[model samples]
Target: MAEKAEDTGVIAWLVETVKTVFWALVIAGIFRTVLFQPFWIPSGSMKDTLLIGDFLFVNKMAYGYSYASCPSIRIARLGVDIGADDFCGFIEDREERFFGADPERGDIVVFRHPVDGRDFIKRLIGVPGDRIQMQDGLLYINDAPVQVAPVGTFDEVWERQGPLGNTPSCSNGPVGPGSICQKERFIETLPNGVSHAILNVGDRPGDNTGVFTVPEGQFFFMGDNRDNSVDSRFLQANRGVGFVERKDIVGRADRVMFSSAGRSMFAFWTWRSDRFFKALD
Candidate 1:
């Protein structure tokens, strides 16, 4: 009789434990999907402003909830290729968002690609009905050139960076590994008086683009690393990000929660203590 009672007690404890774990996971998933989403800087396109290994959380509440607020878990090695559409696709292609608000110019925004489902981060340069152009590497809005002042050069090691092992582009030619790769840095003030650092790696094709008139309900974005970025300056048909729709906007990146200089975040010794909780300008 005592043995039977002990067995029943053990079974009850196990069942309660399972229920607790299941609820915990459900709550965490909801929190991540509707409140904040974690993002890692995977490329150097926004270099100087955002580094290759900086990690941040996108504030989903800043611009209200959209279908893009749903999380897309894509771990290639694990064969997991989920997307926002897979989770909240029924709400996609809708022009309206729940409690929607527009993103201001110069805000660092994350949004889903108009064609592909990949997420991209860039500085918002043009809102709807704005004309954007780049002439001789100078940004112009509505035929008025934005103010740019030369700052010091941005320097980094000319070596493989992050897990992708991408080589940094330098204004100075043919820089070898272990040497300083330098790019001309400047402070660009937009029409709205917002200022941010931008890098120039000599002249590139994107520097001489014709005026692009942003359509209604769409926004234009560009990377701070002007020459290397494939942004709205380029066409989406050619693998570049064209104008992004308002419904696709996920959230704003306000701060770097953590940063790792090494290839993997698990490398404790390579953690960058200085960038933790560093607010973005």
Candidate 2:
């Protein structure tokens, strides 16, 4: 009887442990889906604004939830066929059901790439029905040149031995081995009074662009690294991200949660302590 009671106690403890773990996973999934999701910067497209190793907590609820934001779930088709379109058409139409406020200009947003459905982060530059153009690397919205002021030069040491591998020490300019590349930095103030730093690497292909009118229900995005970013300056047909639809947007990137410059996670000294908890402009 003593041995049997001991066995029963062990079984009860195991059951309770499993129950706790199961509930913990469920709660964590719900929190991640409805509130915040973590993201890591993989490229230098946003440059001085966002670095290659910056980790950010993306606010999922910032623009509300849609089918893209949720985990995959199989659901039976239940809507009546109104004879207006085919079954696939109806499914695509109802796939996106967004709530909350729309994203504003100058907001750094993470959205699904329209062509390949990959997640991408860029600053929202043009809204629906806005005319955007670039002349000599200067951004002009609605025929008005946005305020841009030269701040200073940006210089950094290029360590060819980091985990990130061959950091671009040069701005929009060319770089050579064992040399320091200095690039001009500027502050661009959007129409909404939100200002951020931008790097100018001299003239590039995207410097002079024809007028682009943002379509309705779509938004235009650009990288702060003017000459280095692909952005909306290129056409989707040409293998670049074009206008992003409203349903594609995930959320705004509010702050840098952490930053690391080392190639290995164990390299504690490569961690950027000053960038911790830095708020994004």
Q: What is candidate 2's local distance difference test score?
A: 0.80
- lDDT of each residue in 174-256, candidate 2, tens digit only: 66665777778999999999899998887788999999999987899999988778789999998889898887777889999
Top-TM-score structure, candidate number: 1
Model 1 lDDT per residue over 119-235, tens place: 999999999999999999999999999999999999999988888888899998888889999999999999999999999999799999999999999999999999888789888
- TM-scores for all candidates: the values are 0.97, 0.85
Poorest 10 consecutive residues by lDDT, candidate 1: 227-236
Superposed model 2: Cα runs more than 4 Å off: 71-97, 160-166, 169-173
What's each prediction's clash count? 0, 2
